[model samples]
Target: MQEQKGKYEDLKHDELGIKVRSDDNPYLSADLQQKILQPRRLSSYFIVLIESGSITYHLDSQDFTLTDGHLLFAMPNQIFTPPAKTGDLKYFKLLFDENTLALLPQQFPFLVNPSNAQTLVLDNPAKERVIKVFEILNQLLISDKYETDTEIILAYLNSLLSEFNSAYFKNKGPVNILNTNLSKFTEFKLVVETSLTEQPSINAIAEKLALSTNSLYRIVKEYAGTSPKDYFINRLMAEAQRRLRYSNTSVKELAYELGFNDPDYFSRLFKKSTGKSASDFLPRQDLSGK
Candidate 1:
């Protein structure tokens, strides 16, 4: 199928996959804006820090009304579109790839399959700090130089992530290591992705991560704000949604592909999690796949 999605390699010019946009720069470049606004997945990760704006943005089939002091994040392979219309908005948008993400010292738990609250309302203090970091990187990126100082850019990028990371986890009851729950949560997520066809149980995942079921539950709850079983189910449901919208697989085939022993059971679980049967979404969706 023809999957018209945006990837960092296709979007980058400086080899960093780092693009920043605001009122100052090309707010929405003609070359990329229309494709981005279309219903497609992004290959690069994105963050939008809204200084002031009134627009509805969709991420993973959910609509978010962005306004003053709001920050939004999107991960790769996720169905996302920029605001259909840009209002009298002042915001900074940052996009980078997984390689660029490895530059940071910390693992942003939010980037690793954020369970809830993709948009955060920041206070003035946090907002100002985020704005400053964005400004610094913006200046460096758009600078006309012989060679892109990728190292320097990565340094500021790391700081930007650190600032955002601290703010992201501020209310999570005081973090010890920066990647405490984040790293384990990522490991847990990885285990599920690899075993999607195997349909591994929660205990198997916990064992792989060297944690007991209880510890796994507590950690997942603390980090993702959901139990491990619920978190896994949500992940499965999201994949099912993606397939329904973007692939040609029938619901029954999708269930089998996702390791469900029975298509009928998968259908029920889909309705419980998403409030609509797969069949309900199929007819309205534009199904295509790579």
Candidate 2:
């Protein structure tokens, strides 16, 4: 079996760490656009709104079709494969890095993607509003004559994300911005992500988050449908899958990289979690957009 590794891409515009593209405007050059059509790992947040027509996008080996008034978003480090061709597709695509995200005054919880939904269906009114915001962002970033103030750009960006956050959570459930349980759950995910490699115990995580073991378990199970220990195992396995798909690192090296002391133990855990041996999991063919 031949391995197909994905190229890692970073934000092109370093000054703003953001880029917006629409049907009328081509953000990347012909060469870069071709690269985008291939399988790659993105180091920035990616969102696309389908205003009209339709297209299918390949993300992490799953195909998602978006039609008019639909939106799709992918977090950083996910494998992305743009459609090979867009026939009469009208859309808006936004890309921004974490550094750009930090400039906003308040955090948008939806960015954490608690619902595990990668796509949102926008109503007519919400669709119109989102399109208008995209147009404004497009004009602000692509202007050659006037250098838009960073503050002005950030304001529009903030508004656009707020709209997305609201629409994303509206149908899922009632979300109070100050809900204590939700906040604790979000904090738990963040802490796990921050120290994933360390493989902290459930009690340690609960202590760090100022929650009891039982409270942490309930919160994690409610949101993730798994206990705290299982959540950590699942997250580690997911990261392992991502790394395996994008790189040629051997099982031993990969285990050590993920902070596992014993390669055999990591292999067993991987098999238990993924139902495939580390070696059998490689040479993934779908990564080539097949």
Candidate 3:
């Protein structure tokens, strides 16, 4: 089966939302083939468990090939674009807001600092447990009286997320060594995201992270498999895509907005990183005609 490119929808859901194969969502079809495969961001936190097939998923600037047993997560304000999909793909998705996360008794550390790798390749046992939880939540949401039954929905949501968080953090490298590596990497990413406009130099970033320049290099390489400079550039490029796709801003304007000193350089960099010129790169989020 092949996926058809459907019209994009600005899907509106209540704060706490759930959807499974049986739902009538534009993103999910009756036959379980994905529609609305486009580049866009999610307003709410998004999680999906893939049971089969492949997905060329673009989260920020990184492209991840997710298949069966993979659980992918996207925090709010993060850009998530499902650019390509296979007809064989089967998945369950859950979307919720910060308030729903707060309803849980304990905060999940994985949510606070997403691992270096966003997708968790779960073991068979873990996959079965996740499937069971998702089924129950799906049943709750599709219930006729769900509006008044939000508390029960939320309780199950918390439990489902807890299971996901546990599976995501399990057997992830050597925890003793990875704990430090993961923390430093997570902190560095947050700083880059928050201070991306400044376009901080490698030295500045290393100093802010309180690591020696050489140490910073290894840490970034360990997590991102790229130099800090390249990683930051990629981050900027993802932002560039978001802005360009959402509006008709000129190339020069985009450069300045992202704090690049030279528009020409920004244009070259964008083209180099994305394999397409900024002007020629098509927008995916503009749905005014719809």
Best by TM-score: 2
- Give the Cα error of residue 117 in candidate 1, in Å: 1.7
Q: Return the lDDT, model 1, position 223.
A: 69
Better of 1 and 2 by TM-score: 2
Instruction: Compute each candidate's TM-score over C-alphas.
Output: 0.81, 0.90, 0.65
User: lDDT tens digits, residues 1-290, model 3?
Assistant: 01222322332224444545412333445343333454456766777788777776777767788788887888766767665445756777777766556555655556644445577778898788878888887776666653535556656776777787677677765564236766787778778877988998899989988899899889888767899999899878988987887667888898999999899999999999989899887545453412
Scanning candidate 2 in windows of ten residues, the lowest lDDT window is: 1-10
| lDDT (0 to 1) per candidate | 0.76, 0.83, 0.70
Residue 3 miss distance in model 2 (angstroms): 42
Per-residue error at 199 for model 2, in Å? 1.9
By lDDT, who's the top model here? Answer: 2
Kindly list the per-residue Cα lDDT of model 2 for residues 108-164, writing each as its tens digit. Answer: 777767778889999999899989989998998888876667777777988989899
Q: Quote the positional error of residue 127 for candidate 3 in Å.
A: 1.7
Worst 10 residues of 1 by lDDT: 1-10
TM-score of 2: 0.90
Q: Candidate 1, residues 1-290: lDDT per residue as tens digits?
A: 01223333343337777889887886456757655666777788888888886777877778888889888887777787666457677888899987777655556665654445677778898899889888988988888765555667777887877777666766766555445566777678767665766878898889999998998898889767899999889988998998798677899999998889899999999999999989988887752211
Regions of candidate 3 where Cα sits further than 4 Å from its true position: 1-38, 51-68, 77-90, 102-118, 140-155, 169-171, 176-178, 198-215, 271-290
Q: Please list all clashing residue pairs in model 1, or write none if there are none.
A: none
